[model samples]
Target: MKKLFFAAFTLLLSLCSFSQNYQLISGDQIKVSKYSSDLDIVASDKTGNYFAEQRWSWNLRAKLYKFDKNYNDIYEKDYRKELRGSIFRGFYPIDEELVMFSTEYTRKEKTFTLYARKINKTTGEIKQDAKEIGTFPLEDKRDDFEVKFAPVSNGKKLLFAANVSNKDRVSLVTAVLDPQLKREATATIDFRFTPKQFSIQDVFYTANEKIVVLGKESEETQVGKRKKKRWVFKQYILHIYTKAGKKEKEIPITADQRFAISGKLIEHTDGTLALAGFYATDPKKKDLSGFFLSKIDTDKNELLLTSYKEINASMIGQNYTEDADDDNDDDSKKSKKEEKKKDDDDEEEEIPNDYVLKSVLINPADNSMVITAEISQLYVYQTQNRSGNMTTYTTVYSYTTKDILLIGLNAEGKVKWVNSIPKKQQEKYENPNITRSEEDYFSGKTAHPYFSSFAALINKDKLIILMNDHQSNNVNPEYGHKVKRVYNFKKKSNFYGISVDLVTGTMKRKMIYDNSSDGIMMPRSAYINGSTILIPATRVKMFGKNELKMSQLTIK
Candidate 1:
């Protein structure tokens, strides 16, 4: 298994050529220095064609960029002419045409329309066939709900997750589109949730439409008291939906108290479906590991297939006794000093044992369901900084690891061999502002990390995740502005992109275009192109102005 994993890894890298400075497979690294104030990569056609709508500003001005088979610039135009809000939502393909849409932002008391447009594949012209599907009611102003596009049986469906602005009540709206992408039929779902002291983190179905949604919905209750009170996440929940919104089954990740579901649904040509994701359980006192795999399941929701366990992240810790040098006395003395130092280091910082991406996939045999997930780590540190710092100095700090965890379950839902990915090195980033802390952090606000990572499920067991590099601009010396210091306490995290193994939860690739090295990582947006991945990166103009830069990577 190790040899096979290595062979596959080597082959992936060999398929492309990358220089330390930049990575490219086709198209000279074009310097597209435009800011996509907001953007979304709709979908890559089966032929590997990419199309997306990139909004350039907070003021509702933006354009669309399309790429051909070779990733060459096919066309670009301003799609947001009179559209009020240009916040990006998602992309989907119908037949031979591409459809893209952005969220509607409200300005003033009046409400605007939620627009969806179709693009002409051959001419690369923007088709004004855009129509407003729904409106954001005054009672539904919360940012938790968003629209996602998926290919349905005939045309396509837009899945909108709706929940009460400040309540636990959640609703799933499935809007089927017509040939021109007009909303035809809609399904309102109360969906399903457990009453076991858990939250619905994600909601989606399998590739072949088998219902499967993942969430770190732990049976957690507060323990301890006041300042010392802590919430323990016991495990992960994997749900299989054999029927549409009717029947469902649940499973638990039983390794460590920590498991994160990251990946998508896969529909195979041979009438099989699978789910790809991983978990981060405490291997020892120091290792946070993960594994990725393709799960198989059938309509009845029985565990018929599973894969070999793959390692996600593992650290070399003080838990292991030292392999002393030949000189015992001197080495022993040094070891004692190092041991003390190691303990001190452990107090303030916690290493990321594993990182699983949250993505969805489909089974080629039948595009029946979707894969939705919201998996969180079992044991993670909630770093609090109250030392006069008003700005959130949040960033995903990375650590190295070896060992990839891979698992798979089949359509019959049989557990496959849980494989271990013995990778040599791995990397991780700090997530901020997403986790829940009953007591607001530092200045009375939640400071838990956001899952700034995303993934895409492709052919084979090969999955791709772009773990976003996040950092606060107000605190960043190079990026921060003077007056902006006043707003430091309320800034959001930014993202840069990285590639990791979906099966083994390992960093298979990393490249930063704007900074030469992995300076300030930002996942401006990404698009899939054959064996290559095109990521658009932006850097503030050298003159303190915003200037966007683009980076394209050919993954071997």
Candidate 2:
């Protein structure tokens, strides 16, 4: 199988094409011209032939648009006035119709309600009135509320999860529905935890209509001869349920060397589920040193945990350069000053093990899975001033991204191969002085740098990774690292696709789309539909305001 994949990767190299067959989906023609922000492309079906998008207009008006396979505009409707105080969640295209869900937040009453509407995909006509599926009361104030409504789709079935938090407990209410917006069943689970000790990692809706929840359980214990209380991060708690919300299993996985970091939950082709994540090596540290995969066998009422496999940092991408002194800067240094400088340069940076596990792609053809994540770190700085007895302190936050890693796992959750695609990205921003809304907290600040989130496109023969590269035109081949930062309203970015060989772990990057000078590409809104990649971009228009355009990259 590996040989066959390698051969296909080699064969695709000869057929490589960098020229983009651009399609301009002008906002003007589609009645979505007001705002270029919040653009996204999603397919209604698995074949990627039909697509739809829900975006916000310049006046904060939410609208929906649909398109055919050839990128032709079909319908566009604005629902801002109709769905007041509501934010668009997601949409599902069923045959010739569309189901759109939005979460409405009532500030005065401090409440949230899930609403759904059906529309004709071709005519842009709302076929059904906005129906309230469920309403949830907020425990926190409107300004401090942070919980969000999560909606997921499994083939033709739809599921929605709304979280309500009290003093020390959180109630998760999940509802299963059909394509017609009919509720099938509802499940509610309560999680109790001590503040700052335990946290929920993620909640997923599996294809088999099960609710799987992953969370961290922490407790303090005595270790030293002094018997001092030491906080030991406990095991990961997995709560799995049936479609009707009955608790089926509770698996407490013991952490190996360090605390486990939970990622995505992948549903296998054979009805089993795989929980993928990494574990830190030291309890005192937060860096990941090993990868762990767990399988929840509902049939046997058994939870299988694989031995933690150490991750080879060398397999990471070239975005980071080694110690500067490792290179011969003059064979001999006679000056004492030069020798001292060389010694200082010899100090190498220890890359952190913490990575943001973004996605997991399953390949049923060869019974393999590809896990994707990026090395990221948050740097916080503080400044203090003291005058006599009075003192003041200020805090700032910054983020950095290093190389991306891809690991291939077999059916049994064993690591088959590993590879890295190197790139350096960073953002300079200050901590928010004022409180933000729940939407801002969940969607991230739009002013920050936008990075592509999809792990990789799994082709029959090779793996395709899409990333942001500001220096694609003048990349340095000698070194594997490049640094770019976006501060204030100034940003420079380009999209690059890296192709990796499954068998040999070889990597090659090609320019997918470049922003002409001052423009920016919105990667969060980018979507991979079958063999094509679609993303929205903002370019400088006449009045210094930006004009919205869509870039479509076809994959052969």
Name the candidate that leads on TM-score.
2
Worst 10 residues of 1 by lDDT: 1-10
For model 1 the local lDDT of residue 16 reads 33
lDDT of 2 by residue, 1-556 (tens): 0111111011122334432222222222222343333455645443223333334433234566555444455555677676666666656554344677777767778777888888666566777789998887775654222333344553566556665555667567778767777778777777667534555556666656777876666677775456667555566788887867677888776554455654556677665777787776765444556788878776554668864578755445243543344223222223324334533532321223447676777775777777887766544555566999999875644455666777877766788877665555554333432222211322222323344333367665567776566553234232344444322112445656666666555666665455554245566556676656666555534454455444555555
lDDT of each: 0.40, 0.56
Name the TM-score of candidate 2: 0.73
List the candidates' TM-scores in order.
Answer: 0.54, 0.73
Write one digit per residue (lDDT tens) for candidate 1, span 429-464. Answer: 245222223221111111122123233434333444
